[model samples]
Target: MKTNVATTLAELKKNEKDDFYSSISFANEEIPLEQESVKRKLDKYLRKFSYLERSSHQIHRKADQLLPRIAKILKSYGIPDDFKYIAVVESSLNPGTTSHKGAGGYWQFMPATARLYGLRVNGKVDDRLDLTKSTHAAARYLKSLYSEFGDWTLVAAAYNVGGGSLRGSLKRQRKDNYYDLKLNAETAAYVYKIISMKTVLEKG
Candidate 1:
């Protein structure tokens, strides 16, 4: 019985590792998990992102309520449902949070970007603070990014680092691929973290 239990535990760990390191579809694109470089980065983030499992009770609870609504909104805009994880990445499924740069709410829309996407962001009415409005605003912004990058991975990167900055990096590095392009630390880790968060929420 002890030997059998040990074998089962080992098998479980192997399966969990495979689940973390295996190829996954993100934004309707197949990520090349067989690639060594991609696997390493993903493993690194999965190790760090494991904190979510330990300290994410509230996040998980809120996500149970919010993700379905976010999914419907993303689908209506023709976005892949995977993009809903961006909210988890941005604000950990918490609303009414603001970044130092003024990106706020679940989707983390900056005031200017929120307004550009047809959300009102003013003293009297900061629409970025509203879950439904901010999500719609995020969809429009992500759609614009997709239009610009023509690739979902690049679109996700552009969402993090700003389209213009991502474009400039692609031009300078001569690499259009998110994994290949040279980026700041935060942007470099952004896609991996999103993937990790998606795995955690879905697998749990």
Candidate 2:
């Protein structure tokens, strides 16, 4: 099984490299492969010397295992198919993932946010660890965020930071565009990371 997994990953890496120069469409936007930002992210994922390259490899391997079921759930919730990569960015498709800040699960929902989205978070059962349930909760949360922001990129950013924080940023900065607003490092990189993951997975 380990050998098979290795062989599969090797093939996936080869395919990913072959398509590294191709553009990908997400949220009705075309991300040009030749763009410096895109190229940088691709390098970060594929380069042997980059620190994040190993993590990127693990993410793609996990994504290959998780995305089919996730895509089905996203479709059922009327969420954009590309939004599946949020799980890749959040928890790398690890259903049991927990963050230092107390977020948990494949979608990295905090306890309160999980409950707010109708996910159970009691001691007996943490629904956040249940991929299907957490995905539904994430879809609902994302739908609400999109309703508030009207931009998928902003929605992705807001998912990392709270919607209130994003709204406050918009108000203070007087700019509604996600790329235009100066944000904390993590929030700023959130959408771009998702896009990068999407590109790698789609190409692989």
Candidate 3:
């Protein structure tokens, strides 16, 4: 006898509804959830994103066009591919957007940061909007943060909250792990969003 996959799915869904209510009742009883027992379930929940498909064909096309040039520059400076996803999340391959705070371009560099990184800013031209130049600048900044924190997650967090801010948060939280730290909302979600975008885009 062959098992019907649709029937199995229906049964699983029924079981899931039962389990959800059961868990709710247990939670209301003030019982601590067993971390080990629920680890698989939590992993399954988070991995829902694994099915996400990248629909921005134009973004992929632009990334393909830009990545080789970006990678060549990063390689010359000894930077890592992890930084590429930052660009993916920042501008989605769009170079013309400016954040309300004045961050502009594919890498979204603010005016001060852009100037600090040796990018020129003028009335008519902002080098931060230049893809090749801004990517190289972001690489150098991320590399500097990596040297400071000695952790990729921390370095990535520093990109959002500033190295000084993350350093203070690390001390206050007593954890260097980015996911474990109580970061500002935007910074807290930033790394995970980047990872998710990269995973979907690469797989798609």
Q: Best lDDT goes to which candidate?
A: 1
Q: Candidate 3's residue-wise lDDT over 35-149, tens digit each?
A: 4433343334225434433333677777678877777777777776656767877887688988899888888888999888889988988998888899779888988887899
Error of 1 at 123 (Å): 1.3
- Give candidate 3's root-mean-square deviation (CA, Å): 9.0
True-structure lDDT of candidate 1:
0.86
Best by TM-score: 1
TM-score of every prediction relative to native: 0.88, 0.78, 0.74
Local distance difference test, each candidate? 0.86, 0.79, 0.70
Query: Which 10 successive residues of model 1 have the least lDDT summed?
Result: 19-28
lDDT per residue, candidate 2, 130-203, as tens digits? 88898989989989998988888788889899999999999999996776678898887677777766765665
Ten contiguous residues minimizing lDDT sum, candidate 3: 24-33
Q: How many steric overlaps are in each model, in order?
A: 0, 0, 0
Ranking by TM-score: 1, 2, 3
Q: What is the Å distance of residue 185 in model 2 from its true position? A: 0.6
Query: 1 or 2: which has the higher lDDT?
Result: 1
The Cα error of candidate 1 at residue 193, in Å, is 0.7
> In model 1, where do residues sit more than 4 Å from their true spots?
1-16
